[model samples]
Target: MAMAADKPFTLLDRCPPSFEKTAQGVCKLHTRYDQYDSIQGVGVGGLTSSLPARRDGFTPEQIDLGRYLFFDPLLSVDSTHSCASCHQPDKGLSDGLARSVGVSGEEIPRSAPTLWNTAFLTSFFWDARAKTLEEQMLGPLYDAKEMGNNPVQLLASLNANQQYRSMFKQAYPAASDDITLDQIYTALTAFQTSLISLNSRYDQYAHGYHQALNQREIEGLNIFRSFVARCAECHQPPLFTNQQIAVIGTPEPEGMPLDIGAEKTYNAPKLKGGFKVPTLRNIEKTAPYMHSGRFDNLRDTVEFYTKGRGHAVPEGVEMNLHWHIWEPNLQDHELDLLVDFLKTLTDESFMPPVPKDVPSGLTPITHTVQTTTMINHSNSAPGKGE
Candidate 1:
């Protein structure tokens, strides 16, 4: 039986944030959650969308156009990669590797996070660098390693296409200008914002559907809320995260250079190890997890949380910033339940299908990819086909 089946689950009932004590704050919270739930049916709420939605929403034509742009490798300088290359739909919108490869096939720092429910995030990037999803849209677009295309070339490619010109006419009838880089980013951002993931088992569980989670998952929930794991502290109600930044001391993997996670964006005072706390929603599919994409599976991730980072420490030990003092050891069954519980976060409905036709009249480019491949790790890889 589900643990909360017997009684009303007092999920949360604290004094709200001090700033939120007034009527205006309460109304603001309601409006945010209402919009958040309107797009994302997930049961939890907070400022998760990297920023508030722009007034401009996508039309059917714009969605089709954006879908094409997402998959077209021609946007890249060398025509070697697309957004789909690193953020594969099947892999929970992530590539399931530590660092992603560039258009030139060179490895770059950071992992690709799922676009699912990103509409709710108030800040974007693992470092929480970008303030809005619109701003975040342009990062990979011009990144040397990712899209690698300059705005001039990108705009030229779109302008040359008849379908894009027509789609732009339909999307922005007033604008005399046919196509620009801003329009392309706006379309892509709208589509990304529309990528809402909810209707997961966890949502059902939260909505009083007692059957959503099985016996193990129920036990896992208990432990997750208990002092032993205390995941609820940061990964709190609804969205499963507090939307705050913290420095969890995950070491830099061998052969990979130390990425001062938040320091690069926010400066040294924010702490050398700090990174944004990512939502655990649909976590099972988004593997090779963490900002650096270090761990391969949920078991490894759970172990990392329980054991804590082994070697590296945050700049100041006395600060004790985001360091978690987990239970020294976890039992086998306990770990099993935790993994099972996390699986409930999966929401297949949120996954977007590749568009059949691009608004730009571009054909979806196909690439030869190795199936079911795991990235080679120096710690785990065998020597000489051993």
Candidate 2:
């Protein structure tokens, strides 16, 4: 069972430069979207929506303690895969694999979702199965094909380590002598909430810097929000997701049966093949797209939307595809423009320092993704498409 099944755990990850310590040792996060406060933020294009509730009653020590747990593979049953193993920083907090390989080297059903801005989310997982972030941790931490560790084994390992014992005590200065499962959930929740990303070129344009995006990109943004394409209906901006489940009829890899997404969660037939609309904040880096990682790149992913409604759905499946899925019939360059606009969302400003060593002395599975410099196209006039 997941630790603290009786309680709840909050989430965010890695204290970035935006994090600051108060005189009382509480951590405060400063974000760009602070200006957009109301439920319906009044902003450029009138496309921005209000963010959801976030948790942050955590100390810096707790955030730091969670950081160690995040990168250390000891959280796994056999001391192999760490949380970072699937969600790496370099790749926009995603593994960049079509589907993640579990601790047993077995291929899982879906790709790893990025952890950026997770603090603002009310739902967890592609199917929206878990209500809280702590509940979500149970999926990967103990799934036989995932981290493969149980609560008893997990507590035993952490309690056996003196450094961990000290760290937990420090993180929870008022807690008991030995480490408890609640503390583990708290620390992890603290760190996960710390992972924030809001400073992007699109953010600049959204803030009234018309020059932040070139002419083509601005048009692409228009198309994205346009009723015909209607990309923004679900992937609404500011956060780049409405955080609702949509049955988009995305197909699985060849020869694979349907994964029947949120239907199992709510037990509604109409919800079949539905998944949470993921954040497009750093969509450029987290490729092969979709929950099953069906598409390889942004161009392909965008192309899927234009290929007519339910075009990719396997035959004989009368799925309740989201109404947003339609035949937009966008052109080649339009597809490319959408990709350019998406690339403008890249922001790695909140990356936390990867711990060099953990208390367990286990080699951390630090998934390192190569960083590439994005072209500066801010305020550029309409020109030939790159």
- Score candidate 1 by lDDT: 0.62
Residue by residue across 14-101, what tens digits does model 2's lDDT show?
A: 3447776777767777665666656642332354455566777678778888898998877989887889988888888888887676
Regions more than 4 Å wrong, model 2: 1-16, 20-24, 38-49, 368-386
lDDT of each: 0.62, 0.78
TM-score of each: 0.78, 0.88
Candidate 2: worst 10 consecutive residues by lDDT? 377-386
Worst 10 residues of 1 by lDDT: 1-10
What are the clash counts of all predictions, listed in order? 10, 10
Output the number of the lDDT-best candidate.
Answer: 2
Task: Give me candidate 2's TM-score against the actual structure.
Answer: 0.88
Candidate 2 whole-model C-alpha lDDT, 0 to 1: 0.78
